[model samples]
Target: MGIELITLLIVVALLGLMAFGVPLGITTLTVSLVTAILCFGERAGFFIVAANVSEVLHKYELIAVPFFVFMANVLERSGIAKSLFDSMAIAGGRFRGSVGVQTCIVAVLLAAMSGIMGGEIVMLGLIALPQMLRLGYDKKLSIGIICAAGALATLIPPSVVLIVYGLAAQVSITKLFAASAVPGLLLASLYITYILVRVRLRPGMAPIYDIPETGYPFFKRLKFLKGIILPAVLTFTVLGVIYSGIATVTEAAAIGAVGALVVAGVRKEACSSP
Candidate 1:
């Protein structure tokens, strides 16, 4: 009991040092060594460290964390977001503030598939932000859209934060993913509503683009609907199985990732023809 009290004190001291600007690794090491010595006497302290290392090494499930990270990185480099964004913009150009809305929309979908913030920001910033700006949208609004979407890229599903928390708490990771969906959409809705309302109130903030002065054909509209719908169905299928007890989180993520690839391939094939 005395040793436990001493350990608690050492941890608090380390956190205080961090609050005062000490580096985390050094602070943690210094505090832990002192705690171990005080708790078990100096001689027994060495054995405790070897046990900690052994525990870390024994966590095989942890291998999934880095693989998921790498999968996200790879998906970004594969141009999947570009496909999704362009598909969304086929009709997104005609309506006022639609481009900004589409930007948020695509960012949410992309973040669902990939949780890499840097890639989300840079990709959308370069591709979507400039398009919004050149179309006569206000500078501040354009920058806000990009920055906000980027900042939020990691908070939603497939998030590294939730995964870490789930692992620590021994909570079900699939539930964590499901739990994030409601809030993710809520935040995204807030952003879209804000942008649309602001654009409406000011009128000068978001510019509307006319891809064609005339309305597009109904058949073309049907085709565009197919483009977005197919992928949505596929992703839903994968997630449904995972969250509904038909499959595990690992199994579901694998299925979802592959489903995305198949959908992307279909879209690319459809577009490649004359």
Candidate 2:
């Protein structure tokens, strides 16, 4: 009955806190601790808390988040994402609604690279949105492009959200990464198709401006293509290492971190070149 009543209080507290807009992280910590204390005696609860906290602190699966996040931060500030966008946008010259389509494409590609909204949105918002708007795209469509594309954070390989979700759910992060691939493509494809259809139907929504294509010559396009292809290989490398009965999640995470770091380093030098 003591445990039962404490459980009840914990639930009530969580509901009230959420109703009043308390941050979820804090709410979860507080309620979970309180419930543990209620379920076990104080001494037992203390040991359990210490043990669980230690386990979490020592976890290896979570390395993917920070490694990928660092890779993202490094890549974002270095301007690799912009190169990708510029290359694609120039290649798709003069096509109606191509900018919107490009957003989805770049977003997916960037998602695999960085997988963070802050980096993704700021870059896309600054670079792509202006071009789309200048081409007379609807503000709604432009906004949708940025937001929807940026949301690839949830589904893209190296996705930070999925990394976090894997840690919380105690699942193999690589499997989740692999599972998201098909769905991520599907979502991006849907967005692109919608844009093309909408532009075709209204023609007012996304007018094609006189796109001046200086085009990223073959070498440059090939260079930017590395940003897209390397991630795929690294993703498979990490996931392949896991599912092939070789490495554990921790081992795979280490591989991902090393791979992302190496890629970011190479890309950094390229972007820094005159």
The residue-by-residue lDDT of candidate 2 on 1-274, one tens digit each, is 6768776787899999999999988898878777677778788887887798787767776665676667676656656667677767766556688789988888887776666766788888988999888878899989988998898778876677877788768887778977988999899899898989999999999887554342545554454354455556765786577668598655665676677677677877776799
Q: Candidate 1 clashing pairs?
A: none
In model 1, how large is the Cα lDDT of residue 225?
Answer: 44
What does the lDDT come to for candidate 2? Answer: 0.75
Candidate 2 to truth, TM? 0.71
Q: Write the per-residue lDDT of candidate 1 for residues 63-83, one digit (tens) a residue.
A: 545645555655556566665
- lDDT score, residue 7, model 2? 65
The true-versus-predicted C-alpha distance at residue 200 of model 1, in Å, is 1.5
Off by over 4 Å in 1: 1-61, 217-220, 264-274
Q: State the displacement of the C-alpha of residue 124, model 2, in Å, after optimal TM-score superposition.
A: 2.2
Error of 2 at 3 (Å): 16
